[model samples]
Target chain A: MSLTRLAIKSLLLRPARTLLTIVSVAASVAVLFSLLSFNSGYQEGLQKQMQQMGVHLMVVPIGCPYEAASLVLEGGEIENYLNESVAEEIAGMEGVAIAAPSLMHAIVRPEDGRTDIYLGVDEKHLELKNWWRLNDGEKPGPGLLSEDDAVLLGWDAALIEKREAIGERIWVPEIESEFSVTGILEPTGTQDDGFFYVPLRTAQEQFGLEGKITAVQVRLTDPSMAAEVADALDARFAGVEIIRMEELLGSMTALMDSARALIFAIVAVVIAISGVGVLNTMLMSVFERTREIGVLRATGAGRLHIFSLVWTETLALTVIGGVTGLGLAAVAARGVEAVIKRFVPMAPQEAMTRFDPHAALICVLAILGVGLVAGIYPSLRAAQIRTIEALRSE
Target chain B: MAIRNLWRSYERGSETVHALAEFDLTVQPGEMVGIVGRSGSGKTTLLNQIGCLDRPTTGQVIIAGTDVTALPERELVAFRRDHIGFIFQLFYLLPTLSVAENVGMPMLFARAHDRERVRAICERVGLADQMTALPGSLDGGDMQRVAIARALVNDPALLLADEPTGRLERQARDEVLDIFDDLRADGLAIVMATHDLEQAARCGRVIELRDGRRLEHAYEDSWPKAHCAT
Candidate 1:
């Protein structure tokens, strides 16, 4: 039999201790794997969310720009509003291609245990959101919501409202408005899939916020002219703050990176603790097998052989733990993502716990590194055992 | 194999206790020798020296012409691995390994493991049916047989057994002695330490020790001869 097989068999001799040690390692590795996968998934999801927004800058009423941006991207009622005239003024600028004014209002129904978000927009808003596709083969653009009471339902909004086909009527109890569903947007895997679209004037009048919009999503004809356009808007608009999308993305990513740093520290501590558990288990095994090691020495095993045998057992423990941890992480990704969203601010609507093979590889390598480090002392102790003394040990 | 002026001492607190002192022995190929001594009489110590498991305090253990005491630790290990084998009284077989694994352990360390040779040796030791069984599942006799099989797996020139049959029943002890007889007939030299006088008489020559010194040197034909030495 090979040293590796013998080492594995030795671990099997104390099944409970071996299993407990492996489980501790697996617990740490699972956390590490989930952290790595979240890191990759969060970064990618944030970038995708930004790209799907299809706007170079957002002009909102002076407040916390990040909170205002979050409220606009994810549908929520804003505490402040920008003048509706800002959209027309921005559209008249040289570099600005489209300035889509929007009024977002959320009606929280505690009894229903849900919040209904209403987004008010005109044709220019649709022009900026060119990626929106309508079900029932209808084109989503300027005339989609031409009627005063016409509403465009997002994929999830239609499903929740049970209004999938065109010409379906929906009654809004909070706003006391009855509207016809002219079109339903297909699923876009974003926050947009959960919003109800209405005409800007209708939403303003019905919500008693006439002549006011929450934000204006601006797309520039020349992307490189973003700084010039933002500076011009800052000078022109006294009550509105211009938030560049790139700066917003950088801020969000930096926030996530800080959170990730703290989590990585925690994971590191956990891994270190698990490494100690491995060392302890191996040390106990070595201590218990003194006479057996002596017998091996008597049968011609050198110090190196003893060292390798013990070290190989340690590696086996970690490898099994690492693989089991990976599987556990994969199965629990959804639950972990939900927990992350609860703690992390501005979490993207897209999933943030996707599987990444590179992350898995890094976790495996890290486990091996832990195994190597943890194996050293125990293996050395086993190897340094004097044959005569060991053989005489009870 | 020859041992010259072998001395083994241990420091207990402020006192130095000699386990084996000024001992000398010479055994020829194909000869079976027994070392008889009571508790604390250095029988195990002498076997440890012969097996290269322990070093002499100040002496030479020349096995197959190489003075093992002079060899470096690494080369000494190689020398022991290639030329010497040992069987312990307690039959310290690894519980994790099966009988076959235990038997092939020496060959595994020597980097010359051969499955067929391991099987042949197991069969020779009458452990052919118990090859796949773990040591914990085997009786004392079967366990000792596995230990014996492991010692012989390397095909060593000198086999040092410390109370090989000390833990076995009468029937098993006789069976082990018969195996030793077959091994000696095959030209393999053996040195065994035992407390049983009856068992010691089965050897070609027997050396008796007391207080780390030789008490007598007896032969099977002569029955016993008193040869006391310090």
Candidate 2:
């Protein structure tokens, strides 16, 4: 019998096991791609968010690095503060071009109000630092408490307060301080969407803390001078620390790199395991089809012919499994796209979530290689089976 | 003589099987012989050795002047394709292929044979009508006819049949016997292994084997069976 027909029949003989192997390998590979998506997507989002907003330095209070980092990144608590004078002091420093003082604090939801909203900083210097271009409303005025009676809501902040932009009044519960929404910023999949922005004086007054703020961000005259400015600031301000944007990015990227490495290791191990799976399945098939192979051998099929019959069969099975797995993954990505759409309407494009076709092709080629190599030794074994033994194997 | 020094062969293990012990056989350019033996009589093993599907451990198996017993496995395959035809009891037709494909299989592998000869063999087997049908759909007699066509596709010099009538009923067996008679009339050399004495009686000569040796050769029967051999 020709190897093509033989292989197809052999694989089709045990439909469930072959399909199960296909699904298992596909799942492992999909998970690998999922990790790829997460690491690259997250890293891309962070860099893109930073690129859009050109803030180069972030100065926060000493101790509690993770929490403070999260606060500035994901708006973890909005409840810390640094002096407004610090911005002025840093602005006079040699390499510093602009020092923007920002207040970040939280207030309890109003007792009678139906939402659990908190008030975060909405500083002019903070907005200028982030280049917070608005979709609506005017910029905050440039005086202490100048915009204290007003606020700007981000996409998620508006949902939190259950209010709309342009003339919605909300009260802060813990301090009985009230403000109106004056501006709304666009969605960027960054921290801005979760916090409310207001004047530093207004946040201090509302939270009942005076002369205190969270972080003082500095912009350098030259972008390359950021590390030097950060070092100088760290030396100048005792009990305070300076963080360059690049450093924050490097560590975040490192965390993602570790995840990438982990997935790489997992993919290698699973492929090896599947190689054994291919071998076992083909071996059983070879044993069962001994009589058939012998018949062919007796009919003048050469050793190469016998070997190719085995090799082709192995190739066909693995390639079918690989393709089916990828097809399922394509369907799975649609589901993931839908879930992400429900959360971030202006999320990154769906193409961003797709696996690169080359990578996908590589996965398929890897699967084919796994199948054939896995079958190579077994095929040779089948070829070595004597014609008499094969004919008599019964 | 194509070859000489032929001897008996056996495969031994714990069972001590003697497939072809102390047996001397010969085939000239044109001859039709019938071999009759009971199960375990080694008729099929003897055919396998002559067919080059196996090598005799101690005997010399020469086919068309080539010492096939000592030939390498690759050349042995080529030897079988080039010189021998095999007909099995189960009618080993590939189920997925059409009748024509099955007939074309040996020719395709042999490759040295003419393609028109393959078409002519199918026509001779009376399978021209059923050439497009797969083996799965053919009746027993027609299937045997296809098997005969496959055996004749390469126009091989030596035809070996191992109980070709064993799987068929009396009518189908008789139909297959008719084809064998025709081939003998056409002067094709045939060695058929069968368990039925009545079928053996129809051939030009009958050789009865026991204990892996030829017990008797009824050459006188050829006078009466001469009409079948034409």
Candidate 3:
């Protein structure tokens, strides 16, 4: 019978208390895991989204910058647009490498109630989006759209509306018109993978807005001069908002930083409470076994032995709880991700509830540390007991 | 084992209580020394010093030819582990462990891992049939027997028992005394503290204590009775 066995047996003697303590510690650990993983996933998702967009500056009508960015970058309802002439003006600006304009509209098919995104762009828009590749069929020619009504389907759109999409016309109930699919765009693993593309002039004609557009995506010749160029453009276009990509990234990072701080605070409180719970349980055990400890001492056992018994019991409880909590976190994270996707369709398609090995290791080490600290006071109390005094205790 | 001028005192608030003062005694191998005293007579204090469970405020306790009183706590613990065993008045068996597990505790502490010795000692104490039973299921006499088995499991040279049969019936008390006699016959030293004058008279030497000091006429010629068959 090692001290470990003795400790385990002691805990088993009071099975109810032992189980309750384990559950308490496990609940705290699960909360910590969930919060930490969410923070990591949220930050990683935002960074990927920003990096994949591949634009330095966005020019949008005043008060519609957010709505325009959400539509182009996340694919959703849009009720705003800029004049088509704004794209030409921005293209002729100094230090501007490419100024691509696009118009975004969504139509719901009555047959399935599924919404489809229609993004109208000029020939320069394709060149500006360097990641876009033609998977099959034909690429559009270099010009604004004409009366031909040719369209290119996004990878996801092509898959959903397969066969009927290629070399066949798909009806748009909103506009009461039909357009021929000329090509299929390859999967870019971005917001663009779920949209349909048509020439800018065709969208303008179909929508009865001959000179209107949605937003202008600007690529700078020198990326470092983005702030200066954006300021110059902001001054020239008083009715538009010129947002630098770096500024947008910085604001998003700041928002996530605040969220991370709140989560970290919550984790700290939970760890502290669990630590106290461990201490309370061990102290109660010691109090109940005071005379038993005295007997052990009288029978050639030492203070170190008493200390080890109490500490071992605490460690066993915490370790079991921590492992169970981690397993629960892994399972709960998947459900949480699903709930987030159901409510927010624009959420990152990649897993947003990540539990990497590094995070898991840190969580385990931290819980063990809590166990050690929590066990200290009770173990010390056990070690300091006088054999005669303890035996004399009723 | 010998004690020399051992004194133990405590400060209870503003008053000082001297539990033991100038306590001195000696016992040879195969000796059964009984300590007789009233409630505040310091017999328990003497046993504590000799067992190395506590340090005396003043004086020396020499066990196995070493001054255990002078040894540090760490060394004293190891010394106790190798040489001494103790049986208590209440028979403080762990309620959770089986009789065998309770008896095996001393060997476990010694890291001996000798299952045979534990079984042999349990059998010697007549608890072989109750090896797998928890202490709660055992009677007072059986519980005391388990404590005795635990004490002897480590095969220590000295055993200190405080009121070993205090809670047992007359028949059970006689059984415990018989076991003590058998232990003494096997060349192991034994020290017992008891209020039972009949049990004290059966020892090779009896020491009486009062006001933390030894009485001169503790042993008498008439103490040994014909009915005592040790």
- Please identify model 3 stretches exceeding 4 Å from their true place: A51-119, A122-147, A152-196, A200-244, A334-351, B10-17, B218-230
> Looking at model 1 chain A, which ten-residue stretch has the lowest summed lDDT?
A68-77
User: Candidate 1: where are CA atoms >4 Å away?
Assistant: A58-124, A130-181, A184-216, A220-243, B216-221, B224-230
TM-scores of all predicted structures: 0.81, 0.74, 0.75
lDDT of 2 by residue, A1-394 (tens): 3447655655665678767766666665564454445445645665565566557887877767577655544424544456667777887899876677766654433454433323434344644545554565334344312565877777777876777657788776556778788766666466667767776667677656677767777767787788788888888887676777887657656765765676567678878887888788778878887887777776767777778778877787777777776776666876655554454323445244576566576677778778878889878988888886787777
- Model 3 TM-score on a 0 to 1 scale: 0.75
Please write out the lDDT profile of model 2 over residues B24-118, one tens digit for every residue.
67765556778877888778778877888776657676667788878887777887887788888878777767787777777656555465776
Candidate 1 at A321: error in angstroms? 1.1
lDDT of each: 0.87, 0.70, 0.83
lDDT per residue for candidate 1 within B1-230, as digits (tens), equals 99998999989999999999989889999999888878889898899888888888999999999999998899989999999988888998878888998899888888888999999999999999999998989888888899889889888899889898889999999999999999999999999998877777788888878989876533433443322111
RMSD of 3: 7.1
Superior candidate under TM-score, 1 versus 3: 1
**All models, DockQ values?**
0.71, 0.34, 0.58
Error of 2 at B53 (Å): 1.4
Q: Regarding lDDT, does 1 or 2 come out ahead?
A: 1
Per-model chain B TM-scores are 0.92, 0.87, 0.93
Proportion of the native interface contacts kept in model 1: 0.92
